[model samples]
Target: MSNYSIPYHDIDILIPSQKFEVNFSYTSSQMPNFIDSMIMRLLRISPLSVKNIAKFLGMNQRESRIVLDQLITNNEVELQQDGLFHLTNKSMKYFTTVDSIPKVASILEHTHSLIYELTNFNYIAQKPDNNMYGIKLIATSTHAANSENIVRDRFQKQFYQLIEEDIITLKKIEGRPSIYKMGTVKKVKECTVRKSLDLHVDAQAEPQAIKVLDSIMSDELKDKTYQALGQSKKGNNIRDILNNLDGFEQLKLNQYFKDGRFLAPNALFDSINPIESKSSDGNHLFIGPCYSQSNSKIILNKIKESIAKNHQVSSIYWLAPDDVFWGKSLRFNTFINALGQIKTKQNTDLQLKCFLPMHDEQDRTSVNNYRKIIAKDQQKYFYGIKDGILDGNFELIVVKNEFAVIVLHVLDSEAEYLTSFPFGSISYDKQLVNGLVSLFEAWERPKDDGGISFGQMFKKHSQS
Candidate 1:
């Protein structure tokens, strides 16, 4: 438990749950601008040497040191010793009072600014019964002269993250001394103090990078001419990360939690083909074009039953090859709107049901990131996403392609809708493609033999 600077009153400053990532980069979450997160962390655990800080960051020593120096230059942190640093007196004083400021934010303005002001006034946070947070001042210093006013001013001057990570606005109350009514959201309070998104799905998840040199040379990542993806300078480093991927059958990444907030661009994701072990039975699912968008319940139910049959189905998993969580995504407006409408507690339940590990949860996009990207608010498409990715928890295999499908193998048993092999797309391989068709042909039987889809083919195989 954290010792909050201000009196929480009835507010509970709980940490939001999320999937922890080892290295959440600026490229991933554009808000909170690494600088802001580091500064805040420094202030909370101040008076540390630059070398110590660098060592703490290890692989990020250089970047961390540079940012630390920048903080001093910016007057956010003061250099006290050879390598030691502390928050500037001004910052200390401001933060001290940040605990109890009014949190009523303008839905039209920067949400981060409101959060900053509220923190300055001595409040960690408070939300309405819906769990969609409203403003609640916890007051560290009840008499700091128009505490709310000062906080508001300071926040107006600083930078802010515009994502929906830690944010809420105040609604007026007719009779309460400080009634910050909420919208229809009820989220458990969990503030990690640090600003970043680390999504670790399973407890034993580990970090692994692959060098994608071959991929860089391929048509998937780069342009038609096959030139590197801009960062020719980043060369082999990116390649190394890609190569390591060959060892694993799947990959997962996390998004960011907004710090305050900012505006950014929308991005997209792409899926590669011939992914092995995509399904639970440790079998490979063809990678082509998945019609998952058009067919929902049918696919979901099949996957659900498939998993339940064998590998002890647990959950679902879904991932876009690449994505930008903002207005640009195909599902952005829908996802945000839905999240906004639901109560925070309900949102929490949704997170568990869907298994959105990156932060124990996810919600609407309040603003665009600096990159100008937005999430494809269509969470409906991603519901039970994790399970879908796992191949029905270890039973059947469904892959998508541009034209047709290639049913690799059906486990020992037959799944309901799954009995109809090759539901969606097929792999993009010549030899493999022909091989699959041959296998399917061999499994066919005579129509009179029973009335299965291909009885003639099955009879031929029986005779053989």
Candidate 2:
């Protein structure tokens, strides 16, 4: 078993920081991670001052003083009082001595923050014929080992598994005693998802009922939203979705777009273009609007060019929310509607018609541009899906905002896909995840009353 220690990365989410591609001679790999960092940071700046220590340790004067007092009591350091703690002459000499335990301990503790990649060497040794040193991968007895050497061998086997999984990577090497490096600290992508799973009564008996009850309560948030842009439920009314946006404060964004035709609050998004395609028969598809629909069109185009389903979209169908003031209508505020009409009427062979699922309430501003759409005298069918729900083409999005939440689960099984932001901005580690999940539960309802389940449809489609 090797006596040397290995450092592990802190799995904390962070606002991106400037990362230095550092290649340093790591002193050692020991525990007391924060202190180890403290020493390294001290050496980098001046030879350690209380001010510097506070900055490095992220402590204020009062807390810094407390720790400084402890170091002084241990005789590990001397306090300048007016300024920082200085290493005592004896302590300095002791540490500076080449092979002191403190020196080795400090080195071992400082090696955890680097990101490294393998550059070839399997293992290293002092001389060509010396014993092979470094990590080795293999299963060892999970049975508790009585000896230190035996225990280390088991851990070595486990370490290799982690390495192979890319949880860590080898960083660098040097002479004398060989050292292995791990983890080049960088922004690891994470997603904040609001998952809604149908309650399993056997497992989630208590909480599921609590969730349903919560939904029945008139939520200030939901009520405010309903007041702004909610539509009356009819069996066949389909609303055209517009945008899902991200916001810093979800409540604020929701309130700002209370009218229901703006981006979802706290959604981080990017533009995506979907390809267009046709089925075996010349059926036209009404791809939903905004960037998601755009990506769908692009993807459909590729499908047309590929053997998977050489199809092309002959026309595009879109939605215009009640808040949308343009497109279709020429008489209501002619200028805005004119611009909207121009946008929808782009291709000669393709048509860009408006589709709004919900009926307009008695307000001129609400239906200003919708008059021209009039569903073009076509019968409106209640959508197979609802707001914040994707019927199909869930994975067709191309470009999305920088912020996105990866929902692992949703009510029933409409998707195993990514939803774009502004759905109450979520993050991987925020304490609010539980609250957000509860919110989704309150708002969730069956998309179809007697219609087939999305899961059943998905399975049927897959089998076909």
Q: In candidate 1, what are the lDDT values of residues 338-438, reduced to their tens digit?
A: 43343222222122111121110121121112112223333232321111222221111222111113211111121111111111222234344344333
User: What is the lDDT, from 0 to 100, of the residue 350 in candidate 2?
Assistant: 29
lDDT of 2 by residue, 70-139 (tens): 7677565676655656765534533443333333333331222212111111111111211111011111
Please give each candidate's TM-score: 0.18, 0.19
Off by over 4 Å in 2: 1-98, 101-316, 319-351, 361-464
TM-score of the candidate numbered 1? 0.18
Q: Which candidate leads in TM-score?
A: 2
Q: After superposition, how far is residue 285 of candidate 2 from its true place, in Å?
A: 11
The per-model lDDT (C-alpha) reads: 0.27, 0.28
Error of 1 at 256 (Å): 31
